[model samples]
Target: MKRTTVIGFLGSTLDASKQDAARWNKWRPTVGLCMQPDLRVDRLVLLHGRQHEGLAKFVTQDIASVSPETAVEPHTINFDDAWDFEEVYTELLDFAERFEFEPETEDYLVHITTGTHVAQICLFLLTEARFIPGKLLQTQPKRGKPDAGGVWTVIDLDLSRYDSIAKRFAEGSRTSTSFLKGGIETRNAAFNAMIDEIEQVATRSSAPLLLMGPTGAGKSLLARRIYELKAEQHRLSGAFVEVNCATLKGDNAMSALFGHRKGAFTGAVAERAGLLRSADKGMLFLDEIGELGLDEQAMILRAVEDKRFLPVGSDKEVESDFQLIAGTNRDLVRAVAGGSFREDLFARLNLWTFNLPGLAERREDIEPNLDFELKRFAAAEDTRVTFNKEARARYLSFATSAEARWDGNFRDLSASITRMATLSPDGRIDRPAVEAEIVRLGNLWAVEPEQGTDALAEVLNADAIARIDPFDRKQLSEVIVACRRNPSLSATGRELFSVSRQQRTSTNDADRLRKYLARFDLTWSDVS
Candidate 1:
């Protein structure tokens, strides 16, 4: 029975704009259908609060309306309707402790949402409970209009992979209260050492921080986390402004960051404050700072370095006092070398720098992240959860194992976690789920959209190997997938390698091709 795959549906009492309701609607049936071989025995249970009995019935009936055999039965736990946050949490914890005790095989898949206070309590406690591992899914409810679509965040639970990020976050949980608020799990020694520097900058009287890391390495989150911690100290309630330079391309972009004077331009019918003004004495997070044009960078550099800015069509420099935090995925040093970025601007912004570690580098944070994820999943389901020891060990073993290079960092960790959590049965994760995820990951890396192997082609076209940055297991798998998709050498070269735009420019293409192929130590025949 411990080996059977089981899928469980969990939802909260608070249904926001019914978007959470709709997400769970899509999640359950899709998982059930995706859970190949239904005859394996255990029943699929959809857990919801007694208050949401009607909503629960609706979700299941809706799923059944489309697929009758996969209808999820509503499982209501014992809890009082009128309970305080603590009481609700305690009750949910009690339920979560007994989650895996159901008389069925240990494998389990649990789906949920971030709502009820009880949900937060129960699932937060699930991390401490070592039961069988399973899939953990969470949906954040959005409010406003009913018909508009809401956002959902999903992660498969594999604690072993995220050990580095999880451990740091856990350590941070003692001092910072927003543990539940999303963060990059950068506990790797590289980031552990770097975070201390970042913290110092946050505490410094006027030290500006420039966050340098790969794309989606939680730079923005870390910046916001620093602001949240410091804002409370000053007793100043200011807003946090996030500016993605890569996204800013035109006049609308100009006005969006720096304010425009009234009748400043054709569209300037009225005076409007930009994100900088809105941030006032708050924190301004500039993401992808390297992507900014020299002109925009010059504008921001003046404002941040000197605390003054000139509005559009106006010569008067506005005095703006705000904490400036910058994040970039591009290499600023290289940008400086290429003359794409200003050395003076880089020097000014280099008051404080924090380099965040990618997910693969930090093996320690994975388990804690896994536990945190489970707690999240449990809370969303309004159910308490636990990870079986065997599944937990298997999940963690991958961390210290030889084959892993987490190129995407925390982003990849979240993806792997979501896959593992949703595939577990009876709330207990099994080995099969882990293996299945590896295969899925392998397939993901095997190919690009219209090319064969980026790595393999890079190798054959170029003389040197192109080592993948933030190397880890997941991305390596994807490289393999790319190789599988494109089998021929000429295709690898002409299609993947020959990307240069110059006369007989196979030199550039061949260089890229060689670097990619060298990562896997393969030649043209490897794909063939």
Candidate 2:
């Protein structure tokens, strides 16, 4: 059985009475705590100031006379001002840190009846944070009897222990998850689970988040949604600032991100507070973060870690406390390996990395997302649009089928919906509209295959092409495109094996290309 240990401040006024034989008749909280028959306190750790030493001794002796089995240990904890929350909290925190907690062998209770309100709040925080492993012990005087030993109640901070509170929390989690998904009622289990985790992380942490996916896979939209969610929760106060790093070039990149002093460069007519500064106390979404220059990447790393960076042509450093959400379609790990991107910056952003899948990967969710797209279109255009049963069936069948490449992911879906909606005569999309849209998409997708087929025909015969695996044919077609664009085998190899070359001590681009051509029963000369 674990022994019960009570820790509390010595109540100078409440525990004080006449030092006479009649003093035993009055009830003191510290004495009353030990006097409880059901809640046996084997140890009492009394916290008090130096001036209250005499009162502490008196209370200790009084508690001992009644409960001789309880061992009383007095600790002198001085507070500059008992009501000063910071001072009191720091003092108590230090005490909690220094104290040896035997949680397994002894049950600890923080007696909230004796301390100042500030101290009580600090104790509650410490207990909730698990700095002090204990429950709160609150005491009240017996009804209409000021001098009587009070009734005690133990309050547990763990919310999961309370069914009602736990249910409310569960409901709140569902609401937050829904909000993150833009209330789409997404059908994909993996996507829904990812959104749930993103919701939790968005609300709980201010750390930088990395959203990586292919183009138009909703990285930018998701980053904005995160900002909006955090704003709704009052976690951020400033405006959401977004910038495409691909658009920022040369000296403009530095001035655009870290701000610039007057006369910083040729375009410096006035001092500019850049996107990072503009996003203070809020979030900064850097779309296409992999496109940023190495110099800018270095500055971003410093700003992210220290929240302080020197502006362009400025000696002084400025601070901006902004959360970062970096979005990229490019493979940053590959970029880092290729020496195009800073490894340290990648390391910092990789801490909370989440890879969002493309539309092709989440085909099951197309139906619900179709409805969401139509709703968005209705709101944006101020005109309602609906697909007839046959049209909806035709569109979904194509959208979710293997024939649809969906190269641009959600953007492609949104655009397809917008086009169909605009073409609908009486706000009703019919089979004709769906068939026309399908033909248009098919023509768009055909452009790539036509190019690939032309390239492959130049190198191999129809029989040779038929022998190649479909997967290898597609990949080889892309390789042939790269080879034709470049002038030589070495240049083409560098473009294709940019990431893999970094792993080797000796990079033989020409030799590697020659071998790959050999696998296809051809020479570089045959293709080039």
Candidate 3:
């Protein structure tokens, strides 16, 4: 076993008594600490003032008389006022820094039973921080036994050593992470990990956070959720103010963000309390922050760093202590390099940046988000809507397929669900609704062919092209061009048969295109 060392202050009143054999009956805490039956204190480091040098020597002798094997070392630490927390803490900190600690060779314990309350608190802090590398040794006078040694208990600040407490903390962390995700059981591993980190930063820090992602990637929703979570925790009092930086421009931008005086500019309207001021003691989410002008960016940087800014046409600075959460789909680093964005402002907001992936990137989570959207619609519209087994399966299959571009991300998914839910007969969606939605989504995603290659020239020789009639050749050429432009045969057919497709109730664009290709002795692989 490693030798034990106990460090504590010399109790002026408790330790000091008549220097005689009769004093043995009175329980001196410092002396009683060494005399504990179970605890074997190898060395005692007693801290005292220069004025208590004689008393220190007497206590050392008293401890030595009973425990001859224990070594007592006195350290002369002086505080002008023992009750002054700063002075006492500083002196104790200096002693802790100067002392040599060897955890492998010696077990160190900080004795908190014999010192000013402030001094004890400082010692506990130092020990907890591992500056002294020790556990806390607290000794109390044994009840109904004045002459007997005190009972001692050791408190280790390393929380991981306690299984129950560590498990509780882990559970709380998971709950907080789930709350940050808006209680959505998101299945994307990368997204879940990002949410976990965001949860920690959101709860522990008041610093500005930067959320970067593509449009409709749920950046605004996440920002609102963060505000709500903080509000629920009682960390924020004022309302959550959100603004799209893309909408603010020119003189109006300044007046909108920083508030305007009664006679600020062209409008000369009444005084306005800007989004920042309105968000005082709360959160301000600046969505599409990359759209703000350089001047606005500079002003925002000042407000973020100093929490004070001059409003439009105002000389004095107004304070708005608000936490900032900036959202952007733009590549800010490139913007900074291109001189469109301020680097200093980027640095300020970059402290806690999180990139949320688009819905396409997290296709596995689409099912859960689909369920969440349906529930949301039901709650908002006051009518429950659900998909039949076949309809739900078909929708999910199409949703997770590569053909579903989902370029608009979560917004597209939410809209699709909302449309189907509204169209559902008696709150139950069936196969017809799913098929109609698929066709609608397909039409919505299709785009006109771009000007490029002549597919007929690439596939057929000069003589073969000459044998065909101009009309048939021209139609075949158009079909081939669409095939080359689109990703799949179905997509190509959709583009080629777009005009004629609306006339037929059940049209197969892919089959139509295949027959047209066969007439020209060509396949999709030939031109595309």
Which 10-residue window in model 2 sums to the lowest lDDT? 445-454
In model 1, which regions exceed 4 Å deviation? 1-187, 379-385, 399-402, 423-425, 448-528
Error of 3 at 350 (Å): 2.4
TM-score of every prediction relative to native: 0.51, 0.85, 0.76
* Candidate 3 collision pairs: none
lDDT of 1 by residue, 113-151 (tens): 434555544554453353425555444434554422244
Which regions in candidate 2 have their CA more than 4 angstroms from the true location?
20-27, 449-528
Pick the TM-score winner. 2
Clash totals, every prediction? 75, 0, 0
Q: lDDT tens string, model 3, 1-528?
A: 899999999999988899777788888889989898789999999999999999999999989988998999999988899999999888888888999998999999999988889999999999988889999998877788577376889999999999999999899888888877767899988889899889888888999999998789899989998898889889999899999999999988998999988987878679998888999999999999999999999999999999999999999899999999999986687678767899999999999999888776788999999999999999999999999999999999999886787757899899999999999859998999999999988987675334222446557767889999888877777676555435578978886678999999999988887887888787777765
Q: Tell me the whole-model lDDT of each prediction, alpha carbons only.
A: 0.60, 0.88, 0.87
What does the lDDT read for residue 176 in candidate 3?
81
lDDT ranking from best candidate downward: 2, 3, 1
